[model samples]
Target: MYEHLEYYGVSKKVIEAMNKIDRKLFVPPEYQDSAYVDTPLPIGYGQTISAPHMVGLMCEYLELREGNKVLEVGTGSGYNAAVMSLLVGPTGKIYTVEVVKPLYDRAKKIIQQLGLENVEVFLSDGKFGLEEFAPYDKITVTCYAKEIPPALIEQLSDGGILLIPVGDEYVQILKRIRKHGTKIAEESLGHVRFVPMV
Candidate 1:
């Protein structure tokens, strides 16, 4: 995993999280052997966990701290949220939403099995954002969006970072948006592909 992290140019903080968390624990039983291969694997319900390296890179972009609150727009297999929960430690919280009920339930159960008390999984439209926990310090969207969702930006706290993949269904451009006062700063993180944010 560290080797994959180096290939993605991820930060040391991300490397630590990657090293500490077991990717195999997040995938379905059949794919457990390939979990650390740095590639995405199907988790049923048409969703796939993002490549491990990509997850690391996205998390790195958030610049997470010990007590920060994070909103994860697509839970998939709950891998990202679980790794993030470790980064945020015991004080911080991770709210992850998955539109598919089965996927949400699976992820929720996996998180519980891991005893990640700080991570919460919800079954609902991720585009709406988790408003009950507004003003997240960081937001990470695991799926692709044609455009940045207004609700996500509105829920971001001042100086918050949002990492999302925006483009057509086939491919996307990873972007990092930083909220400043009433303005936003966007930076492209390069080309990629992901499942459409439904």
Candidate 2:
């Protein structure tokens, strides 16, 4: 998995986290053999565990630290949250939300099984953001949307980083948004396709 992400220019920290987190744990039983293949695999409910390279790229963009509090929208298979938990280490916290109940249950169980104590998975409308845990140091949205949800921006801490895909339903641009006080800076990472944010 680490070797496949090399071409994406992922940072050393993200690479280390990806290396430590087990992708097979988050994949469906039938897809277990393909878990380390670096591509996205179906996880039911019209959702997918993002490709390893994409995950690495998003993590690189976030620039996570050991003490940072992170928010993840669209938990899917919970693979991304697991890797992020590794990146943030034990001192940090990760709150991941999945709109689909079944997915949320599965992800929550798997995360617990893996003993990632600092990560929490919840079932809710991810677009609304988790207000109780506002001011996250980093936020990552796995799904695509026509626009950046205002709630997510407001939830980000000052000087925080947000990585999301925004555009039409069919196509979207992976963007990086940095918050400085009340101002924001946006940069398009690349064109990509992802399931629409529900």
Candidate 3:
């Protein structure tokens, strides 16, 4: 799996996390057979797990540190949060939200089954951001939103980074937004397709 992710520029730490966090654990039982493949598997609620390459690229871009607190907007299947949790280690915390109640419940159970206590799942509208757990060191959104949420910006700590897909439901630009004091800088990572954010 590490070798496969090299083409996408994943770091050694991220690759190790990917290897250690069995995709099978995060995937739905019905799709367990496709877990290790270099493909996206469907989780219910019409959301698909992000492709491995995309996952690799995002982690590489984030440059996560140990104990970093990450806020993920869409916790579909908990795969992305699980992968990130591994790299950030037991000391790190991931507060992820899923708008769909069922997905949120399933993801929470899956993470617990994997013995990850650092991850927390919330069933709420992700667009509003999780202000209760403010000052996130990093923030990421799995689904595509028309624009970056101002509330998300408000939740990020100084010098924090947010990676989100921006544009229409079907076609969007992957952007990396960084915060420096009161100013925020945005970079267009590329174009990609993803599920729409509720």
Best by lDDT: 2
If candidate 1 were superposed on the true structure by all CA atoms, what would the RMSD be? Answer: 1.2
lDDT of each: 0.90, 0.92, 0.88
Per-residue error (Å), model 2, residue 92: 0.8
- Pairs with backbone N, CA or C atoms under 3 Å apart (clashes), candidate 1: none
Tens digit per residue, CA lDDT, model 2, 89-139: 899999999999999999999999989999999899999989999989999
Q: Against the correct fold, how does model 3 do in TM-score?
A: 0.95
Off by over 4 Å in 2: none
Give the TM-score (vs. native) of candidate 1. Answer: 0.95
Worst 10 residues of 1 by lDDT: 1-10
Those runs of model 3 whose alpha carbons end farther than 4 Å from true positions after fitting are none
Worst 10 residues of 2 by lDDT: 1-10
Ranking by lDDT: 2, 1, 3
**Per-residue alpha-carbon lDDT of candidate 1 for residues 1-198, written as tens digits (9 for 90 to 100):** 576577667877778887887888778899988988878899887889888888888888889999899999999988899989989999999999999988888889889988999999998898999999999999999999999999999999999999999999777999999999999999998999898888
**Model 3, global lDDT:** 0.88
